[model samples]
Target: MATRTSALKLLRSSLQNESADFRENQWEAIDLIVNKKKKLLVVERTGWGKSSVYFISTKILRSQGSGPTVIISPLLALMRNQIESAERLGVRAETINTSNMDDWDQIKQAVIDDQVDALLISPERLANEKFVSTFLEQIADRIGLFVVDEAHCISDWGHDFRTDYRRIINILKMMPNGMPILGTTATANDRVVDDIVGQLGEVEVIRGPLTRESISLQNIVMSDQSQRLAWLVENIPNIPGSGIIYTLTKRDARLVSKYLNENGIHVAPYFAGAEDDESTSDEHREKLESMLLGNGIKALVSTSALGMGYDKPDLGFVIHYQAPGSIIAYYQQVGRAGRNIDDAYCVLLSGKEDGDIHDYFRKSAFPSVHEVELILGELENSDGLSVPSLVENINLSKGQIEKVLKYLSVEDPSPIYKERTKYLRTAVDYQLDTEKINWLMQQKTVEWKEVKDYIWYGGCLMNYLQEVLNDEIIEPCGKCTNCLGEAIFPVEVNHRNILNASAFLKYSEFYVQPRKQINKGALKEYSIPSKIPANLQSEGTWVLSKWGDAGWGHLVAEDKHNGVFRNELVKAMENMIIHKIDPSDFPAWVTCVPSKRHPELVPDFAQRLADSLRLPFYPCVKKIKDTNPQKEQQNSYFQCVNLDGAFTIEGEIPDGPVLLLDDAIDSGWTFTIIAALLRLEGSGPVHAVALTSTAVN
Candidate 1:
C-alpha cells in the first residue's frame, strides 16, 4: 500500500521542506519494510536520514491497519531525539525508559487501545522480567515493526558491544515470521555487518560510503595533560561554532571543564554522574543537551557517555583530549559534527596515558576463566545469592559480577537465571569460552594499534578513517591538515597557559564525603550501629589531589615510593590548607594515620605539617591489628570488614577540632573508624585530610 511518492511526501512533511526527497537507498529500505515485510540492515554514515525511513514506514504501516512499531533504542538521549522527530511526521510516538517508570502502565494501555503508533524502549528493558511480562508480552502479537538503533552494538566484535543488546536476538526469535525488522547504524564495517546479518537472518543489506566531506580531520600529539588543557584554552575559542570536547574519564572531564571555565570558556562537564547524585539526572542531562543545541555554551567537556546518536546537526567541532581505542569508535564520534554544516573540525590530541587507559578497559572487559569458575562454583553450591551476598563471599567487584552473570545468561542454553532477587543455576553445563575471549582480546589489540596508526598516518586523515571502516570511496577530501599541507589550528601552545593549567591542577581539591551508614554484619564485634551517629561522624574531608594524577598528585605518588615527603610538597600542602580552610575552623592539632610497613612515612609528614601550622603533633591512631590493604577489598562490606577493630587511639585526645591526615585515601573506612574513635574519646569536631584520594569525586 506504500509507494515511493507517498514516502517522499511524508519525508517532506517531516522535514518541513517541500523540496526534500529521500537519499539513494532510503526509499528502497522503507518500501521493502512496508510493502514486502522483509528484514533490513542499513549501514550508512551519520546524518544519512536513517530515522526517516523508520518513521515514514511506521506511518504507512499504521494507515494500513498494522500494529504500532516498536523500537529498541540504546540510549535515553537517542530516544528523546527520535520521539521529537516522529512527532513532526504526524506519528504518535512515546518512549518507555528508566526515566519514566510511572507512565509505563498508561503507555501500555494506550498501545493496547491502538492510540499510540510507535513505542521506543531500551534493550535493557527486554531483560526486565516485570516489563516483559506485563507490557511487552501484552502487545507482542500486535507489533507491526521492530527497529534496533545503533545496530552495531548487537555484534560482540563491534567497537561498542553491550551485554544488554544480546537480548534483542531472543526477541527476534520470538517475533512472528514476516514481521518487518530494521537495524540502523553509522559505524559498522564488513565483519560487524556479517555478524549482525548472521544474528538477524536473511536481511537485505543496504551499505553506503562512510566518507564525510564536511569535516576536516587533524591529529596532534601532546603527552602532558597540562599541555592539552593549554591547547584547549588557546584554540577552542577560535573554532567556528559550539562543539564537544571528549575525555577518556570522568575525572579528566571535570578537570578539563574546570580549567576551561577558569580561562573564560563557557563549558560544562557531562558524564554519567554517580547514582547517588543529581548531576547526571535525566533532567540535568537533557538541559545540558538543550544548551549545547541552542549554542548557549561553547562546548561540553564529556566522556564517552555523550557519544552516539546525540543529534546536533550544526555542531562545529569534536576535539578528543586523548585518542580513543579504535578507529570505528573515533569515526562514529567525529561523524557527529558537520552533519548540516560545512568545515567542522575534528581533532585528536594524543596523550601518553591513552594506552594505559585502553589497556585497563581491555583487560577488565571480560571476566577471567578463574573468576567465572569461582562465581559459578559459588552459585552451584548455594540455593541462591544476591549480588551483595556474592560480593561478600567472592573477591569480585559488583560490576564484574554483574558482567559475568549477564554474559552467561545470554547464551542459547543459559547456565543461570534470576528468581525475584537471587540468581539460580540452571542444568546447562557452563564452560568458559577462552578461545572466543582470546580472539576478542586480540581484536582489541589490533584496534588500538589501528588508532595509533591513524594518529601518525601520513595520508589524508579522512581517507585513512574511511579506509579503516572499509568505505567504498577512499579518495582524499582536500580538507585535512595532511591533504592541505598545513595545520588548521596552531599546534604550539603558550608556555604561560601551561603554567596556569599546572597551577590549577595542583590546587584543585576534592571532598571525601563521610559514610553515613555501615554495611550490615560488617562489624559484628563492635557496637557500631547501621546508621552512624552524626555527632561521632567526621566532617567532610579535604583531599589535596587524586592519586598519581597531574600536578601535586604526581609528587604525592613519587614521595610515597621514596618514603619521604618533599619540602615543596610540604609547602604546597601548607599553602592549600591555609588558603582553603577557614582560620577559625582550622584543626587545633594534627595526627597521622599510622602505617606499620613504613612507620615513619605518614607520622614524619604529619609532624612537619603540624610544625608549619604551629599545632601540636600526635601519632595517636595506631594500627593495632594488621589488615589487608584497603585497595584489595573490592566492595563496601569487604572494605569495612577489613578495617573493623584494626585501629585504636593511643595518646591523649585533642580538645578542639582535629586534622586527621593520611598519605592517601582509598576506601575512607580507615578515616571513618579512626574518626569515630576520636569523637568517642572526647575529641571535638574531626576534620579528615589526605595528600591524595584514590576515588574520583
Candidate 2:
C-alpha cells in the first residue's frame, strides 16, 4: 500500500496542491495500482489529478524493484506535460518523439543504463519502423507500468477516434504477462467506454463527472464569416487574458492571425506541417509552443493542430472561430481553459459554414472500399513497397495513403506488415471490413448531430455538453452563458470593426507558394524536366479572398459559376496590379490558362483585364486533352501529374511580359505547367494571377 504521507508529499511536490491527502477517487486508483497490482481505467474530468495517480503509483512500484514506467501518450504536447509533471514529483523522465530526433540516442541510452524512470512516447511511434525495430523490443520487458494517455482514441465509438491508438491494444497484448496497465481519458461516452473496456479486458473502472465548474460556456451564433471575423477583432481584446483562437482549417488560421496582427493583437498561426520562414524547418512549431507556455503571445490562431494535451493551467480563454464537429472535440479543446483559474471563457462563434467545414473533414476522415482494395492489391503483387512508392502507383494523396496504411496496420493478425523500410503483405487474403466501416460511419453521423445539439439546445451549454458525454446533468449549471443569460461577448456588432474586418478579408493576399520539388518516380511519362526552372515558375499569384466566403470571396464564387466577374473584382485586380505589383514587371500581353470545363470563363476575364489595361489579349495555352478537375483530385502531386501533358501553347506565343490568368490556384500546378510551356516558346517573363487560393497543406 502507498503510505498516506508519501502520496500527499508527492502531490504537494508535483502539483503544489497543498492537500494533506489524495482525493477519494485518486486514492482508490492508486491503491489498485500499487497494492492490488490490478489494471485500471480512469475516466476523469480535466483537472481531476489523473497524472498524480500514475506518477505516485510509478514511485511506489519503482521502489518495489519494478522496471521503468513506459507511457504511450497520444500527443507530443501531452508527453511534454507529463515529463514536466514527473520532474516536479522528483521522478526522472525523458521522451522520444518526432520533434526531438537528435536527442533520441541519448534518451535511449539513459533508459538502457537505468538512469531514467518514466519514458513517454507518442502512440504513432509504435508504428515507426526505426523505433519499433530498435527500441520497442528492448523495452518490452522493462515497462513496469504501461500507461495509455488519451485512451478515448482507442474506441471507434469515441468522437476523437484515431486509428493509431487502436494499435496500442496490440502493444499491450504483446507485452510481458502480469504487467500493470492503465488507460486514462477525459472524454468518453457510454459506448466509447464499453468499447475501450472490451479492448483493455477486465480492469478497474473509475469514472467521474464531465463538468468544469470554472468554465463559462456559450455559443455566440454569428450570421456570417465576416461577422465572426469582426466579432473576434472586437471581442478578443475585451476577453480577459492570453489563450487560443481555434479555426477549422490552416488557411483560416493564417488569415485570422494575419487580421489580428494587422489590428495590433500580436498573435501567431500554428498548424500541422507549418515550418520556418524557409518552409523546411519544424522550428516554428517548437517556437509557437514555447510562446504559449510563457504567455509571450496573446493567442495562437490555430486549427486542431494545436488541440490535444497542451497544458496551460492559467489559460484565460478558448474561442472557437468555428464550432467543432462534436461535443467530445469541443469539450476537449475548451477544457484547455480554466484548468487553474476560476473564471475563464469557452466561447464558440458559430458561422453558417461550420456544418460545411465539418462535412468536408468527415468525407476525408476514412478510406472508402475502393481505396482499401487498391492498396491491398498493389501490396499483393509485390514483395514490398513504401508509402512514397505507393503514392506514385496509387493516385491517393500521400496523407490518404498513409491513413489507409495506418488503418491496415492496426488490424489484428494484420495482413500488412513492414519490414525495415518497406511494408509487406502477409499470407492472409485481404478483404474490406464492411462491419467496421459501417460502424465508423454510423458513429460520425451521431457526432454530427451531437454538435448541432450543443449549438441549438436551449439550455445550459455546459449541462448540454455533459449530457452528450453520457453523464447526467443533475441541475442547470449557472456558470454557463446560457444559464446566466450573459457573456463577455458584446450583444451587437461594431460597425467600424466590421468595416475593418471586411477590408482586411477583402484584400487578403495569398501567394503561390509553389511546389519546391516534383512528385518522385513519375517524371518519365511527362517528358518534363525533373527540376522546375525559376524563371518559368509564377513570380507571384494573388488570392483576393477565400472560396465560398464573405466579401470578395462571394464575388469570386458567383463569377466562377456565372462565368462573369463583377466590376468590384476588376477594380480589386486593377488596384493589385497598380499598387502591389511593380510597373516594370507589368505584362505587355495577357494570356489565360484554358480550362476544358470552363473554357470561356478565364479567357474572357483575361480579355477584360487586358482591355482595362489596354494590353493585347490572347488565349496562348490550350487544354489539349480532357483531364480530371484539380479539385476532384485531392492529392497535390496527383494534381500535378494530372495537369502534365494536358496543356499546349495555342496560336502564336504572346509577346514580352505575358500575364497568366486563372480563376483560382489550388495546387498551383496549372500555372506552373502553362508558364513552363510559355517560357519554352520564348514568351516574355511570366507572372500569374488568380482570384483565390486554397491551403496547399
Candidate 3:
C-alpha cells in the first residue's frame, strides 16, 4: 500500500521541508521493507537519510495492521534522536533503556494494547531474561519490523564490535519468516559486510559510495601532549563552528578540556562514566549533546563513546587529539562533521603514545586461552556461580569474567546458561577458537598499520578512508592536505602557549580515593570488616603524575630506574603539595611505604621531603614479609589478599597527622593497609602522597 509519493510525503513531514526527497536507493530500501516484507542491509554514508527509510516503513506497516516495530539501538543518545525524528512524522515511538527501568511495565502494556507504533531498546536488553520474557516474548508473533542500528557491530571484524550485538543474531533466528528486518551502518568495510550478511542469511543489500564532499581532511603530527594541547588552544577558536574533539583516553579528554577551559574556551569532557556515577548519567550526556547541538559550547572533548548514531547535521569540525586505531573508525567519527553543511574540517593529530595505547586495547580485546580455560573449569566444578562469586575466586577482573561468560553463552549449543543470577555449565564441551582469535588479532594489527599509513599517505586522505572501507566509488577529493599540498591549520604553536600548557600538565593532580570496603573472604586471617572503618582509613592520597605521562611522570619513571629521586623532583612535589593541599590537612610528620626490593629508594626520598617540610621523620612502617607487587594482582580480592600480614608498624607512634610517601601508587591497597596499621597504633590522621600512579586513568 506504500508508494514513492506517500513515502516522499512522509519524508517531507519528518524533515519539515516540502521540497525534500529521498536520495538514491532510499525509496528502494523502503519498498523492500514495506511492500515486499524483505530483510535489507543499507550501507550508506552518513547524512544519506537512513532513518527516513525505517520511519516511513514503520508508518506503512502499522497502517496495514502489523505489530509495532522494535529497533535495537546502541546508545541512549541515538535513541533520543530517533524518537524525536519519529515523532515529527506522527509515529509514536518510545524507548526502554537502563535510564528508565521503572517505566518498562507501562511501555510493555502500551505495546500489547497496540498504542505504540515503534519501540527502541538497547542490544543488551535482548540478553536480559526478564525483559525477554516480560516484554519481547509477549509481542513476538505480531512484531512488524526489527531494526539494528550500527549493524556493523554485529560482526567481530568490525572496528567497534561489541559482544552484546551477537545476541541480535539469536533473536533474528527466532523471528517469523518473511518479517521485515533492517540492518544499517555507514562504516562497514567489505569484510565486515560479508560477516554481517552471513549472520543475517539471505538479505537485500543496498550499498552506496562513502565519501563526504563537505569535509576537508588533514593530518598533523605532534610529538607530545603539551604540543597538542597548545595547538587546540590556538586553533579551535579559529575553526568555523562548534564541533567535537576526540581523545583516545578519558584522562586526556579531561586534561584537554581543563586546559582549553583555562584558556577561555567553552568545552566539556564526555565519556562513559563509571556505573552509578551520577555526573556521567544518561541525563547528563543528553544535556551535553543538546548543548553541542545548540552551539552553547565550542566543542566536546570526548572518547569513542560519542562515536556512533549521534545526530547533528550542521557540526563544523572534528579534531582528533590522536590518530584512531583504524581508518573505518576514523571515517565514522569524522563523518559526524559536515553532515548538512557546505564546509567542515577533519584533522588528525598523531602522537608518540598512539601506538602504545592501541596495542594495550588490541591485546586486551579478547579473553586469553588460559583465562577462558580457567573460567570454564571453575564453572564445570561448581553447580553455578554468580559474577561476584567468580570475581572473588578467580584472579580475573570483573569485566574480564563478564566478557568471557557473555561470549560463551552466545555460542550455538552454548556451553553455559544463566539461571536467575548465576551461570551454570551445560553438558556441551566448549572448545576455544584459537585460530579465529589469532586471525582477529592479526586483522587488528593490519588495521592499526593502515591508520599509521593514513597519517603519511601521499594521494588523498579522504580517498584513503574510502578505499579502506571498500567504498563503491573512490576518487581524489581535492580537499585534503595531500591534494592541497599544504596544511589548513598552522603547524607551528605559539611558544608561550606551549609553556603554559606544560605548566598546566605539571600542576594537575589526581586524588587516589580510598577503598571503602574489603572484598568478602579476601582477608580471612585479618578479620577485617566488609566496610572499612572510616576512622582507621587514610584521609586520601594525592598522585603527582600518571606514570610515564606528561608533567612529572617521565621524571618519576626515570628516577625510579636510576635508584634515586632527583632534587628537582622533590622540589616539584613540595611545591605541588603546598599549593594544592589544604593548609589544615597538612601532615605533622612524614613516613615512607617500606619497600623490600628498594628499601632506600622511598626512605631516602621521604627523609629529604621531611627535611624540606620542616617536619620530624619516622621509619615507622616495616615490611614484615615480602609480597608480590600490587600490579601482579589483577582484581581487588587478589590485591587485598596479597597484602595480608605483609606489613607491621615499628618504632614509636606519632601523635599528630603523618604524611605517607611512596614512589608510585597502583591499586592503592599498599597505602590503605599501611594507613590502617598506622591508625591502629594511635597515629594521627594519615595523609598519603605518591610521586605517580601506575594505573591507567
Best by lDDT: 3
Model 1 regions more than 4 Å off: 274-280
Error of 1 at 658 (Å): 0.7
Candidate 1 clash pair list? none
Residue 655's lDDT within candidate 2 is 68
Error of 3 at 284 (Å): 1.4
The worst-scoring run of ten residues by lDDT in candidate 3 lies at 273-282
Kindly list the per-residue Cα lDDT of model 3 for residues 1-697, writing each as its tens digit: 7889988999998899999988999999999999999989999998898888899999989999999999989988889889998999899999999989989889889999999999999988888877787768778889999999999999999999988899888787777888999999998998998999999989889999998999999889897888999999999999988999999998889888889999999999988872235654777888899999999999999999898878899999999999899999999899899999999999999999999999999999988888889888999999999999998888888888999998888788889999999999999978988899999999999999999998888888888888899875556898988899998999889999899999999988888788778888787656457788998888888889998888999999998999999998888888877876678867889998998899899999999988998988899898888898888788899999999998888878778888999998888888888888888889988888999999966
lDDT of each: 0.89, 0.80, 0.90
Model 2, residue 103: C-alpha shift (Å): 2.4
List candidate 3 stretches off by more than 4 Å: 274-280
Model with the higher lDDT, candidate 2 or 3: 3
lDDT of 2 at 570: 74
lDDT of 2 by residue, 369-424 (tens): 88998898899999899888888778787888888888888887688999866888
* List of clashing residue pairs for candidate 2: none
